[model samples]
Target: MNAPPATRGGSALVVIDMINTYDHPDADLLLPSVRAALPGMRRLIGRARDEEVDVIYVNDNFGRWRSHHDELLAGALRGPHADLVAPVRPDGDSLFVVKARHSIFYETPLEYLLAEYGIGHVVLCGQVTEQCVLYSALDAHIRHLRVTVPTDAVACIHPDLADAALRMMERNMAVRLADSGSTGLFG
Candidate 1:
């Protein structure tokens, strides 16, 4: 994983809270949005891979302090949205960061990892756009990382809330609002 960085100025793709068990109360509400964004997520992921951009999965620990990445994947695969998890499962080459909170950088080595690779730009994609995505974007901004969130690649429970969050990100953090197709990782 210590290879030279890819993409312009060491950019990375951060996937947040996608490997979920969907056993919670809000699971049903979130599922539809996730399904809607699945294709875009897949496209962005493929582009990142093809462009040799770093892919990082910043997933919630789900209160499992000792749980590993495989355990989380297995749990999600056994629950709802197995289809989603199966297709987007992190491969051996992908990096995984177990986050306990909404922000990926909070209590995680994400900052150091990005810094080690000299990654200054992050393209965020995954579930719950209004919460995890919003918070992580803010945290990224605070850390001086150029943030970009492909709107179609992120899922949210409420469309209105998602729009508002995206607007806030663009206005406050100066985050680049883009779609999977408009994101030019290689170019």
Candidate 2:
């Protein structure tokens, strides 16, 4: 809500697409990968809140561009994964960004939000490591924001794809990859 300019690299924690649309098999295979990161994401959320760092839920609008972020969260919360998201939740202190496209940056206020806070670094923790997660990481790299994807905090449809995505991100972009246990020094 407060979009004031900042001098420091305001650290931000991004929780991406942990939705019911991904979890329920009838919806898609999105749950498997997302579920894998739940524990780590819960940890990150607490750490970020404790450190006074911004917590942003960068989720998909499921292509419904005009949808409200809260509505999507409501829908997800009402679904089968209600128990899963009960712990990792949003409050008045958090920011929620709903994207219609794969990348949070594609036709969204993400860039403005980052710039306003001078978030030169973003701790990426979310679902679908191969899709939205990958795209967001790429966008962060292009914007020169330092990016870190906690290995255990992100998940992919397959282990191989997840490994490949992390490896490629490390090689091609200026990204730092770490397991959840190792990233304790950050927040």
Candidate 3:
């Protein structure tokens, strides 16, 4: 097989499904770590924005006809879990790619968005590591994007699955799993 493609320049950031559904009874298991990781993610986002690199919100639509990027942001902002995801919604210039499934690239503009932005390196952050976040990292590998995921910056409903996701990414998929401090964290 040929090498997975490379997209992006400087560095780009992709914030995954940090929606309300994953913060409560639906998938509360991952909240604490994801919550703790928020500030770091926010800082990285801020840094990315300041550097003029692209910031894409690869959000999950949750299969809503009425649901869109803002809806997802609003739901997480207004819902009971608002405190967990609010910091993620940066003010402007951030792009969004609505995803219908786990991989952000699945039936979405994710690939085009990355290519358009010339994002050659990507940092994957957001919800349940065992699911969407994990799948997207694998997809990133297939896309040939150099991937870096912060260990403490991601979480999952089940601890094992979360840990396993990181393992699979590094061992099976060859992703770079770093600590939260590696990324450019800013004001």
Candidate 3 — which residues are off by over 4 angstroms? 1-8, 21-26, 183-187
Give the TM-score (vs. native) of candidate 3: 0.86
| lDDT by candidate, in order shown | 0.88, 0.77, 0.73
TM-score of each: 0.93, 0.87, 0.86
What is the C-alpha lDDT profile of model 3 across 1-187, one tens digit per residue? 2223531444677888765556336455566677777876776777677677677888777778787777778777877777777777846788888888889888887777667656667888877788888888888788777788877667677888788888999998888887657644211
Give the candidate number with the greatest lDDT. Answer: 1
**How much is the lDDT of residue 100 in candidate 1?**
96
Using TM-score as the measure, the top candidate is: 1
**Least accurate stretch of 10 residues (summed lDDT) in model 1?**
1-10
By lDDT, rank the candidates, best first.
1, 2, 3
Of the pair 1 and 3, which is ahead by TM-score?
A: 1
How many steric clashes does model 3 contain?
8
Q: lDDT tens string, model 1, 124-153?
A: 999889999999999989877789999999
